[model samples]
Target: MTTVLWFRRDLRLHDHPALTAALETGPVAPLFVIDPPLVHGRWASPNRTAFLLATLHELDAALRERGARLHIRLGNPTREVPQFAREAGAQRVIVTRDYTPYSRRRDAAVARALEALGIAFHTRRGLLVHEPEEIRNATGKPIAVFTPFYRVWQTLPLRPLHPSPAHIPGAPGLDPGEIPTPASLGLPRPVDALPAAGETAARARLQRFLAGPVCTYAETRDRLDLPGTSRISQDLHLGLLSPVEVVTRARTLGCDTAKFVAEVAWRDFYHHILWHHPRVLHEPFQAAFRSLPWRNAPAHFTAWATGQTGYPLVDAAMRELAATGYLHNRARMVVASFLAKDLLLDWRLGETHFMRHLVDGDVANNDGGWQWAASVGTDAQPYFRIFNPVIQSKKFDPEGAYIRRWVPELRRVPESYLHEPWTMPPSAQEAAHCVIGHDYPPPIVDHTLARQQAITTYERARRASASEPPTQADR
Candidate 1:
């Protein structure tokens, strides 16, 4: 009997444990089900959806080279997977394990459906270098803080890299269904063109980063004006590049790979958090900040989202996200902090907005990042530790090159006034062919005032939680 390998985020043909395991069983049939709810639902992104389609096409091409083609179907995986297996005469179904709340629920349903069909349902550790529950503390519980978790992650050894299967043994009599286009699926064309798709593009990016930029990654990663990042985050998100493969290759460079490798480890850490505390996706992980009095200033949020925040760095980052479906890591922190702290808006506001745009958006990483920015998660920054947008802009984007690139109106503004353009005197503003209120939106809220307000609000919530009795779970 054949084995059906159902692919989700693991879209690549290379370094796939589930695909390899499926082959070990007998002939293998690779399948991808385009779930409508996930593809066009509230959390759906045109950018990511388009990238996924292209990646899937590339995957089908790769499979054809291996004497097979990716089997595509449209519907719920729970119903479609079982039916597909029956058609292929597959006795077992295998997939890469996913840890998000929704993924868990979906997988549970899929497993039960397959069981009823008498097909073995199995998951392999393919997404992360280490499974969420694998790394443990002194007492064997999963570590909550990233530092300790990363330290433990380092000691855990990794297996050597293996090449893609020489050829995928095809299961005959399976139809390779229609590969849907974005228009057919009702996904809009993205404002920005997506990165090159597939395992080839992913590997090329990883190879280039490991070759050069990685040497200065530690020092230049935070720089806004340079291509300091590896830019393979989307690849990791779609499993075009495997986490272990990236890490193992980075270690071989013999440079200070600790920083670069830690970024990958951070992805693992966030996944672990999701696995242990699935509730964090919808609520504050720290619990006390669950009562944070977030504002309902839709206008402020609109301004921030459209890149008219009047803060150059924040504006640049937001516009970049809108245009490219990506953002610099430092800019992400700054913008997220501005939304939650400066604007006193809910972190979920920014979090959901990001999900709507980011190509690299992963549930675990995006949630972990938002919670960290809002100071409402495990090992989050303190409420008082708010970012001063002007300081961050000047320090990271000293020359305003990034701001100029994203916000063209600020192009003529002198570098001295670029970081805080509203501060420019009328004469200087006129001289630069820009006026603060007319040419650009003024700062919606004074950072100093907003910072104080955020601190007081967080302190109030902290006090309120302290006064309340602990839950039975806490006890």
Candidate 2:
């Protein structure tokens, strides 16, 4: 009997555990389900959808080159996988496990469905270095803070990386439909250049980053003007590149490259947190933060969404996201912090917006970043630590080259006034060829007032928490 390989976010053929498992079986049927939840979710964006479709097309092509093809299915995995297995006469299903609550539940339902049909189910663990329950504190509970969680994560042993299988045991009888496009999914067309997909492109990207930028990554990653960071986040999120391969490669480079390796660890760190504390998805990770009075303003959210925030740096980041389906990490932080702290909006709003735009967006990273900015998640930055958009622009993008690249109106402004066009003299503003209120919106909210309000609001929430102590303190 053939084994079924169920592909989700792990799209690539190389360094894939489930794919390896399927090959080890007699014959394999590779499958991907385009579920309604994924299609209609808030995180779904035309840009992301287009990139995903393109990637599937690439993966399908790669499989064809190897005398196999990805079997694309459209329906709930629980309903689809079992049906596909029964139709194809498969005895077992193989898949890379996902830590997100939605994925976990979906997989469980599929597993149960398969078991009832007398089909075996197997899941692989290496999507993350440390599986959620694998790393625990001395007390056997998941760590709630990142620093301690990271420290604990460092000590956990990881599996060795696997090479891509040369031959995928083909389930020759099964045929699949055409891979869906953004239009087929009823999504708008994306207007950005997505990186080429498949194991080949992923490996080449890793090799190129190692040859040059890996050394300076620690220093230049924060500089928005430089192409310092490895632009592999989308690849990793899509599973075109495995975390183990990335970590192993970074270690092979040594010295400063270790920092790049640590960033991979950071990705795992967030995934483990989400797996252990799934509540972080719907509520604050830190209990005291549950009471935050987040402003629920849809119009303000629309402005932030369309990049018309009246703050150049924030607006520029938002515009970049709208145009490119990507934003620099520093820009992500600035825009996220501006939305949550300065704009006093809910972190979920920002999280959804990011998911909609970022080609690199992952459930763990997007949620972790938003919660950190909002000071509501494990190891989150304090809420009082608000970022002033103007100062942040000057500090990170000093030449305003980054701003000028995305925001053409600010191109003629002197570097000194690029971050603060409103500060320019009336004549200087005219000479720069733009009007603050006419060409661009004014600052939506005064930074100073917002900062103080955010601080006070957080402080009050923390202070107002229930003081009742647990009756059974320590077992």
Candidate 3:
């Protein structure tokens, strides 16, 4: 009557549905498998890898506190999970479900392998407030858009929280493999320092945000210069903090928690979108724009990626992401809009770049966000409704604090010309001890010209999607 509990994103013990359910059956052998392809394959991420390794250590220590320890395996989960389960004499393998396209495929393979060995494979709902199948359209498919989904999501009752087990009986006589360091994996330690990882740290951060930040989140969330946001996206990504725990706790505080809860609903919405339409992974959800022409200019892309674009806000967000493996949600929208609309690069390129760099990159959320900015997803911005970079900078980062912190070359530039340093006269530039094209690079592309051209190109694609043949990218 033993079970192998495989931890994926839901790394925590408190409020864990799968862990609680598994422990009810019998003693549990907690397991974590590090797949090679995730660490070294096409979509590898150094920042996330470093963070995961650190979190695994914390999870292991937490298990030891409860008379259990984490078991590690380094290989394909399809092979490793079942192998470890059988070796531990477990009759079943249990996990909290993940909904990405790749995760679904991996889970299916693992289940098939486990079934062949007469081991029951069970998936529990703990990561999201509602699974894809739980909220559906009239057609019985997951809701395609968020508004209708949210309308239904709020009315549903939430399952009560599960208390952590006082004692966990670990499977006897199994070798818990050693956790590997970044160097041992042939990857460099991340330059951006990661947060104190694990459930305890996750809960502490949540408490800090709840103390005061959650009350004014609706008012100050958009100001990019201020630290007004919860900054818990990374913890949510790794499942150190359960969505249910975060949402339920915030509501209990008696603040106007609607907006914050709505944001959580948005996260659940994207997961449901990915669950229903896996094709969104390789193509746009709004199929009409899949064939949309992208300039994909190498020079423009290089400038945008390295934070050398003449626009200060765009540059600051990209640079901040490089330095800290994190960015404010407001900043995320600005840079994403700049990339897809202004630069007219392929949105997928930006998505892949972020996944490779961000510590909190989740497939459903990141893809949905990139596609939204690109104007090619459900509830997306209209392609013609472009973000004027200068206007956005002045509105969201009015004081230029964010730009100054990330782009020090503009620190000496006066407040008047900080957002548009190229506009400063040569004499004024000298007074500030900064020179455009000398100290800081000039704007790579003219926004006015780019804006006009982008609108025309998108209009042309809109027509093509209705009548003319699609472009090669669509094929």
TM-score of each: 0.98, 0.95, 0.97
Which candidate, 1 or 3, would have the higher lDDT against the true structure? 1
Off by over 4 Å in 3: 468-475
Window of ten residues with lowest summed lDDT in model 1? 159-168
For every candidate structure, what is the RMSD over all alpha carbons to the true structure, in angstroms? 1.0, 2.2, 2.0
lDDT: worst 10-residue window of model 2: 466-475
How would you encode candidate 1's per-residue C-alpha lDDT over 292-369 as one tens digit per residue?
A: 888889999999999998999999999999999999899999999999999999999889999999999898999999
Q: Which stretches of candidate 1 lie over 4 Å from their true place?
A: none
Q: Residues 308-352, candidate 3: write the lDDT tens digits.
A: 998999999999888888878888888888888888999999999
lDDT of 2 at 4: 85
Model 3 residue 470 CA deviation (Å) reads 10
Error of 2 at 205 (Å): 1.8
Please estimate how well model 3 matches the true structure, expressed as its whole-model Cα lDDT. 0.88
lDDT of each: 0.91, 0.83, 0.88
Once superposed on the true structure, which residue ranges of model 2 sit more than 4 Å away at CA? 466-475
lDDT (tens digit, per residue) of candidate 2 on 1-475:
6988888889887778788778775888888899888878857877767777888888888887776788999988889999999977999998998999999899999999999999999998657766777767889987777678778876766677787766665778787877888888888777757667666787798889999899888899999888998888888888888887787777777566867877887898888888877878888887787768989888888888887877888888988888888888888889888888887899998898788877888998889988988888888888789888998998888898888988888889888788878888889889988788887677788899989998998888888765634234111
Error of 1 at 428 (Å): 1.4
